[model samples]
Target: MTAVQPKPTPVGETFDSLNPATDEVVGTYAVHTADEVRAAVERARGAALWWEGLGYAGRAERLQRWKGVLTRRLPQLCQAVRDETGKPLRDAQLESVLAIEHISWAAKHARKVLGRQRRSTGLLMANQAATVEYRPLGVVGVIGPWNYPVYTPLGSITYALAAGNAVVFKPSEYTPGVGKWLVDAFAEIVPEQPVLQLITGFGETGGALVGAGVDKIAFTGSTATGKKIMAAAANTLTPVVIEAGGKDPLLVDVDADLDAAADATVWGAFSNSGQTCIGVERAYVHERVYDDFVAKVVEKTKDVRAGSDAAAQYGPVTMPSQLGVIRRHIADAVERGGKALVGGVDSVDDRYAQPTVLVDVPEDAEAVREETFGPTVTIAKVRDMDEAIEKANATKYGLGSTVFSKTRGVELASRLRAGMTSINAPLSFAGIASLPFGGVGESGFGRIHGPEGLREFSRPKAVARQRFTAPITLTSFHRRASADPMVARLVTFLHGKR
Candidate 1:
C-alpha cells in the first residue's frame, strides 16, 4: 500500500530584505511558501526534461548566452552585491568574476565530463560492453550564504543548470536582492524555460525549499545550521552538499617568507570584513619569525579600515546578529590571556567589525575554536612545525589552510587535513576553477565547483550490453554444475594470489 504524503504548505505574501551596511530597507521579496516551492520544483522538473533533451551541445549554447548576460551585467550585479552584503565593490566584482568563470567552465566541461563513455569490462564480465553516463537530477534546491553571495550560490546554481537540472534557489535572506539580480539576468537569456527560480524568506522559506523534495540540496552556512539542513533533508531522503563554516588556519614555518606570510594572513583574515567561510581565522607562527611577522602584520593591518565609505579598505559586517557573536568571541579570547594588538571587544559596531589581530591567545578560546565570522584573527607562537601542525589540526572544522614555507610548502600542505591548502597564497584555491571547494569533519560534506561540482548535480547512469554469449552462463534457466568450478579457478587465478 502507498502511504499518503501531505500537501505542501502555502508561501507567504512578501518579506523585507535589509541592507547590511546601513540597516536600510533594500528590497522586498516574496516569502516563498511550501506550495510555491513545490510548484517551482514541478515546473523545474518539466523544464529539466526539455533542457536535458537539448543534450550537451544545445545546453552549452544556452549557457553561453546566459554567461554573456552575466558578463555584461557584472558591474550591476556587483552593485547589488555591495548594497546587500556590505563587501567592498572590488571584492564583490572579483567574486562575481569568479562566478562567471565557473559558469563558463561548467558549460564548457559538462559535455566531456558527463557524456556517456565506455568503461572497461572486468575479467568476470569480459563478454559485456559497459558504459556510464551522468544524468541530471531534475530539480535542485540551493540555499546560499550572504558572504560572497554571488560566487558561493552560483557555485551550485551554474553547475546544476549546466548538468541539465533546473534550480530553485533560495539566496541568503541578507542578500536576496543579489539573488534576484542573477535570476533576472538568466530569465533574460532563457525566457522560454523557467530554468532558474528565486524564493526569499527567513528560516521558514529555507525549510520549505528543503521539504519540497527537490532532487538535491546544496547549502553554505554555519555548522549548526548545516546540521539542521541535513536533518531536514533526511526527512525526504534528498542528498545534500553542505559547504558550512570554517576556522581555517594559516601556518608559517621558520624558513618562511615573513613579509609574504604577513600579507597573505592579513588579506586572508581581514578581507570582506573577515566574513569568509574559509577565512584565515587562526595563524600558527614559528617562534623564530614570530615577532617579525607580527610587526609586519600590525603595520599592514593599520592601513586597512572598515566602513561603508568608498575608500574603506573593508566593508561592514553583512549580518547584524554576527556583531554580538564577534564581540563575545573577542571578550572570551581576551579573558583567556589573549592580547588584542589592534581592535578589541569594542570594535564590533552595528554594521562593521574593525580588523583585529590577537596574540598570546589560548588554543581553547572561542576566537580559536568557534567561527568568529568577523575580521578577527588569533596568532599563536609555536615551538616548531610539529606544534604548528598539531595546533592547526586541533580544530573541529577543517575547510582551508595556508602554509608559508619555501622548502616544505607542499609537504606541509599535504599533511594538513583540509579540503584545500594554498601553499603560498590565501584563498587561492577558490579562484582556481579546476580545484574542488568543500570541507571535512564538522565543516560539512560534499563539494561544489570544479569536476566534483558537475557530478554533484547529476546521478551516474550505467549501461551494459552483451555482445556475444559465452559458454559459462551465470543467469540461465538451465543449471550448469561444471561452470561453478571454472568460475572458482578463474577467480583464484586473477585475485587469490594478489
Candidate 2:
C-alpha cells in the first residue's frame, strides 16, 4: 500500500495516475506545458463566443442534454473516480450525483439569475431607463483537487458554463481520468467547439493555466497552494475564486441528542477517509455531556474501517503523502497529553488511516491548530456553548462547521465563525443548491453554487437609456447657472433630513 512514484518522463511527456489502494497504474495523461495550456485557453476564447451566442435558452437546452449524458453514464464516471482516487464505488457515486445536481441547478437557474433586468431610474434620473445584467467573462480556467474530484470541481465548472463561458479544466494529477470523463461527456453534447476542455498535469500545469490569460481562474486545493495561485494570478491581475483547505469543526451542545451528535461526529470526521476539505477535523462538546458524547462517538467509530473493499466505510487516503501528515498530527496530539479515545498514530498506515479520536488535547497542539485532512478528530470539553463556539472559531480556517442542538441550533450556528454551519446536520449546506458555498479567511473567497455563484464567473454591465430631456440640464455644461442652486435645493429637500 506504499506510495508508488512514477518514473521520470521526458519533458512534455506523459505521466501515470496510480490507485492509492493498490499502487497500480489507472491511466496515463499528458503533462500539458504552458504553450499547450495557452492554446487551450485561446481555443476556449473562440468557443466562448459561440457558447454566448447560444443565448440562455439555447445554452440551457444544450446543458440539459449534457446533464442527460452525465446521468446515463454515471456508473462509468463513478468507476473512473474509484479507479483513480481509490474512493469506494458508493462514495464515488454520491460525488457524481452531487456534481450532477449542481450542473442541473446551474443550467435551470442561470437565465433567471443573469438575464437583464430593469431597474428604477431613481428621483435624480427619472428620465432615464436603467437596466443591469451579468455578462459572461469569456473563458475560465479551473484547477480542481483530487479529493471529491467530481463533485468539488463541477461546482465551478458547471456554474461557469451555465453563465455562457467556455472552460479549460485542469483536474488534479492524481485524478485526471475523472476529469477526462467529464470533459468527454460535455463534448458529447456540445461537439461544435471546445467549450469545455481538459488539461492534465501536476503543479506546473496548474501554474500554466493561471498564467494562460483565461478570463478568471477557479481553484480548489490546499491553502498554501491557493496562495501561490493567487500570487501568480496577481501578475496579470486575473480574478480568481479559490475554495481552499479547512480545519472545520463540529460542536456538540449539552442539550443535543447524544446519539445523533455522535453519529454526526463520526461521519463528519471520518467520511471519505477524512480527505474532504470541509470535513470535520475537530469537535467541541459541552462538559455536561462530554463523556457520554465521546463514548458514543467512540462506539460508532469502532466499526468504521478504511479500505478499498465495498464493505469498508471509507477508502484509503487519495494522496499517499497525506499519510505522514496524519501520523504527525496523531503523534503530536498524543505527545501533548491527549488520550487516544479510539485509534492512535498507528492507525495511519501506508495508504489508509483508521478513524482516530483523540481527547484532552491541548488547544495549541498541531492536531487542533492545523489541517490534518485525515480520518481523525480531536474532542475537547467546553464549559458552555459560548466556549464551544470560541474554541471552534479559534482557527484561521473558517470553512464549514456543524452544531448539534435542537432548540439552540440556529442561535449557536449564527455565532460560529465559519462560512456555512449545519444546525443539526453535517455538511447539509453543500447539498442545498441555492445556498452560496465559499469560506472567508484562509479557506478562500468567491462563492460557487447559488445566485452569487452564477455571478462569480460573469461581470455586471449596467445600461442607462435616456427616455426624455430632464427638467434640469445639470449633466450638460450649457445648463443655466440657476440649475446648480436648484439641484442643491432638491437634494436638501430629498435627503437632508435622512
Candidate 3:
C-alpha cells in the first residue's frame, strides 16, 4: 500500500483532504475564521425565521423534497464520500441511504413530536385552560464527525430542521466535500432561504461555531473535545447536544448461538475499519464457551480484508494519525500478556490496518481501556454472565453494547450501562428511527433521533386561559383575608391525610 501523504496548503488559507487509501488530494476547502462562522450564524438566524414561518406542514414538504434530491443524487454523494474517507463505495452509499431514511422519518413525524398540544389542568386550576407547544430554537450550530459523516450529522441536522430551526453545519476537515454537497442540494430544494449552510475547517472552526450566537450546538467527536465545546458554549449559555466517542463492548453468554455471536462480533468490531463510535471495541465471552467462541471469531475474521477494492469488506483508517494509535494498542496488549489470535501489530500498514483481535488482555491495558478507533478488538474471558456484565460496564465510556443470549437478552441489556444496546445483533438501534441514539458518561449527552431529538432543538411554550371566574381569587392583590383561610382549609382537606 502507498503511504497516505497529505499535501500542504498553498499561499491561500485552504486545506487539502487526502484520500487515506491512495495519498491523493481529494478536495480543497477554506479554513473559515471565527468571524466568518459568526456571520454564517447570523445568516442562519435570519433564515430560521423564514423557515419557522413555514410551519410544520410547509417545512415537512420542503424536507421531503430535500430527501428526494438526496435519493436522486445519491451516487454523486457516495462517490464524494468514498473519495474523501477512503471507505468502500458501498459503505458510503449505505450511510447515505440510512441518512435519507432518518430525514424522511423526521419530516413525517415532526408534527406529532414537536407540534402544539393540549396539556392537563388539574382541579386547583380548573377555571383555567392550559396548553403546551414546542417552539423552534432559532439557529443551531452543528460540529460533525468524519466517520459516518452523512448519517451522524444528519441525525442532528434533520431533526433540528424538522423542529423548525435553521442550521449552520461544520463538517470534519476530512469530509468537507460531502458537507458541501448536502448544502448545495438542500439549497435546490429550498431556494429562497439559506436554511442549511456549510462551514469547512478543523477544530478551530468548530470552536468558533460553538461560540457563535446559535440557539443550540450539536457536536460529535472525542469526549475531551466535548468538554471544550460545553465550556466554550458556557460563555453564551448556549445549549448543546454532545455525541462523543465510545469504547463500546459486546458480551457473549454461555447460552448464545456461538456462530451468530461470533459473526456479530466480527462485523461490529471491524466495520468502517472500526472507526464507529458505537462499534464493538471490546468483548467479554462466557468462559464455558470461550474457546469455541474465539475459534468462530477467528474463522469469521479470516476472510475479511481492508483495501480500496470492491471485494474488500472495509477500507483504510480514515484518519492517518489513527494508524499509530492502532499499532500502539496492539503492542501494549501484547506487552501486558495478551495474545493476538489474529493479525498482530504488523497487520497495520501506512494506510490500512488489517483486522486484529487480542485475547486475555488485562483490563487496564490501553487496548481495553481507551478508544482505539481502529479495526481491532480485545476479547476477555468471564466466569459467567454476571462477570461479563461487570466487565462490559467497566469502561468510562457508555455508548453502546450488544448482548447475545436468547433467554436473558433483555434482562442483560437492561443491566448494561450504555445509551443503547442490541439484544441479539449489533448496532440495530442506529437503524431504527424511533429509537433515540446518544450516550451517557464520557460518551456525551442529549439524543439525536426519535421524539427526544425533536424536542432537543425546540423550546416548550405554555399558555393558560381563564375559562371562568374562580370562587377563590388568591392571585389578586385585592383578595379578601377570609379567602386565605379558606384556601388553607381546602389544601388541608385534600392532602392532610396523605
lDDT of 1 by residue, 346-406 (tens): 8876667888999999888899999999999999999999999998999889898999999
lDDT of 2 at 187: 93
After superposition, candidate 1 runs with Cα above 4 Å error: 1-12
TM-score of each: 0.96, 0.98, 0.98
Provide the overall lDDT of each model, using Cα atoms, as 2-decimal numbers: 0.88, 0.91, 0.91
At residue 28, give the lDDT of candidate 2: 83
Clashing pairs in 2: none
Clash list (residue pairs), candidate 3? none
Candidates 1 and 3 compared: the better one by lDDT is 3
Task: Give the true-structure RMSD of model 1.
Answer: 6.0
**Candidate 2, which segments miss by more than 4 Å at Cα?**
1-12
Q: Candidate 2 at 446: error in angstroms? A: 0.4
RMSD in Å for all candidates: 6.0, 1.3, 1.3
